[model samples]
Target: MRYIFILTVLLLSFNTFSQPISWVEQTSGLTTQLTSVSVVNDNNAWICGYAGRVLRTTNGGANWVSVNAAPIPLTLDLHSIFAIDSMTALVAGSGSSSFLFRTSNGGANWTQVFTETGGFINSVQMGNAFAGFMMGDPVGGRWSLWGTTNAGLTWDSTNFYLPQAGTEAGWNNAFFFEVTSGVWFGTNNTRVYKSLTLVNWTTQPTTGQVNSYAIWFNTPLTGFTGGTALLMTTNSGLTWVSPASPLPGTANLSGITGFGSQWVVTRQASAIYLSPDNGATWSTSYTAPAGNFRHIAKSRANNLIYYGVRSNGGISKGTLLVGIEPVSNIVPDKFELKQNYPNPFNPNTTIEFSIAKNSIVKLAVYDALGREVNSLLNSELKAGEYSINFSAADLPSGTYFYKLSTGDFVQTKKMILVK
Candidate 1:
């Protein structure tokens, strides 16, 4: 029996996958919930929270030094954190003053950008280095999403939804995984909604009511929002499913992140759970010493998973979860990988595809001579359709072939490169 168990562990480890998470402590050592976290490369990350505080990490999360950015610390409570670049960031705190701050030199220092003096910011995501947005629950009149394209210099408004009786028009929070893929969720009437650009927004039906935070799409189509019962989605936000979460009862789900195959979920004071099978099941990672989870992020540049609780300081990891699901149902019609947009482009183009199930797949670009130049689908993919940008800045204008291969199934298409 011991050998069998060992073999199973070995097999699961070999697959592109997940493992449990372990974390250290923060410096300030506040037992308050550390609400938000963001990581770049492996060393740089930022965590924000209650009492108008933001914590920065340069050595992953081994240790953290608290940065008191707010002029008036006790006035606002930060709810969300977004790092567009090493230096550029946007922080949303509770209350009307959307405490928007920016750092030019990788958080060494920060400057106050814009402050929405009325409604508090619930969540924030960078649309680009220049453009980003912040969302909050219905406040003042009827506004949900706000956009800033000029490096927080100016703004635009969006009605995430108009308040309805049973259906609240406003969102509890908002976060963007990419320039296109974004999600906005709330408590009372509004559950959550999704959008590609900042333009058209669609409400995604969640399992139950969520109050806290959510982490979405390790890659698109696969996302988990932390709320009532760990709401999950296989299709970006086309549909939402309520899965059995690790929390004991009706608890607010906040921080969530994925490393390798393991996903970590945190609730206030509740032990974090690491899942290998896409949240189908969950186990403990580490019990938070105190505080509630507010934000989480996985550094793609490196494998570090950074986390922040309401007031637990901020912690980060150099390694990530390693549990992966089996490659299943390699069915063609089950998925639809769209052709590259602007087939005959000079520098950049977009490639889109869909998967019916989670699997380790390969997507590569080949020149007309059959020599492979680039590969995109090189990691474990969650079930859903997605589009990725393929920038050909180094290649000459010509014809190329981009293909998708999984197990024995292979598909290829011809693309023209016009410089």
Candidate 2:
């Protein structure tokens, strides 16, 4: 009786610790295909879609109010949006008469800041409250790009000259901007245009003949682009390669966003993929029964929270809970490494440990032949309980060993990858 009770309690504890992470659906109350979503903070976000529809949620999506009826025409197709705050935002519409609109009073009124006759506005990004850039398809043999320094009150087209490739065009929300490192945007010509000074541009070829739609960089050197194909670069866009583990679906990828080493990508179909260790491995975190997820956004106030917008007015929220998480702030009395959860994990598992004092730690994995297969951690940490996620997606099924060492305490444990 005593042995059975202990086993039951252990099983229950394991089940509680390994709860699956997922995306919960939210009500957006519209049927238009939402093209973009921008999250300003934990409590504020904005979504824009076809029919010039704009929805603002000040209370973290508890309710969304339509803010584009009077000044903005119903025939406009808003492609991208950037929210500066709960009240200030800019939306760009594409197609024959591409236009950019700005709202300062939370959407009661809007001002048309910029418009072009034939070009298409693909993206609008703000470095802050004042400085921003708008990217568009090429026109008159040049990429239709503009920059605004005084918020969205005015735009300048004289500072940069980006010549476009023959018949090349930009995709919606397909650019990345870092204030200190400049900007990058992908195109349909199997090229990615980058500008360090936002004045002179250079183009780099991806791995294959691909239509690059989603571009994101953790740093200037390491980045990923997805559209017709998923490609990654580690040498500042000098070269690109495919990841070892292929993504699950065949649909084209539409959006990519990340916080630290965690990444979330949306497909043009009904699925969203998540990677806990950068792009080393991926899993389908959520899938809708109908429609497709067009773009994804991460909250500026919280790194864990993410919002994914569907084509047919659906909103899904997901939290990244499978990374290196600090479990306790209380200092531990001794150093120890607990066995990993789900001993025979397929490709993902959690490893928990405790540190007695501030120390440099190294946790690594080795294959049966004693070859170092992966390096999970090599950093200094304070005395506390920590949980780390380990992914073996690229490795073959085999018995492996993981070692945790801090200060003079060292321990090794065995785990199995069944697939």
Candidate 1 lDDT for residue 94: 61
Model 2, C-alpha of 416: deviation from truth (Å): 39
Q: Give lDDT tens digits, candidate 2, residues 199-244.
A: 8898888758468889888776778886766788778788878866
Ten residues in sequence with the least summed lDDT for candidate 2: 1-10
Candidate 1 C-alpha lDDT tens digits along 1-419: 00000000122223344533335445655655567776766667777777877776676554677665535356777767776665666666766556666666655566776566666666776656787777765555655567777777566784454443353544323355466555454444435656666566666666555443555566676777755667676777666676654444456665666743457666655456667777656555555555555555677465545554544553434244233233443333465557888878877787766666655556778989999776443444445454556778778889999888765457888889897
Best candidate, TM-score? 2
Q: What is the RMSD, in Å, between candidate 1 and the native fold over all Cα?
A: 15.1
lDDT, candidate 1, residue 334? 68
lDDT of each: 0.59, 0.78
Please give the lDDT score for candidate 1.
0.59
- TM, every model: 0.64, 0.73
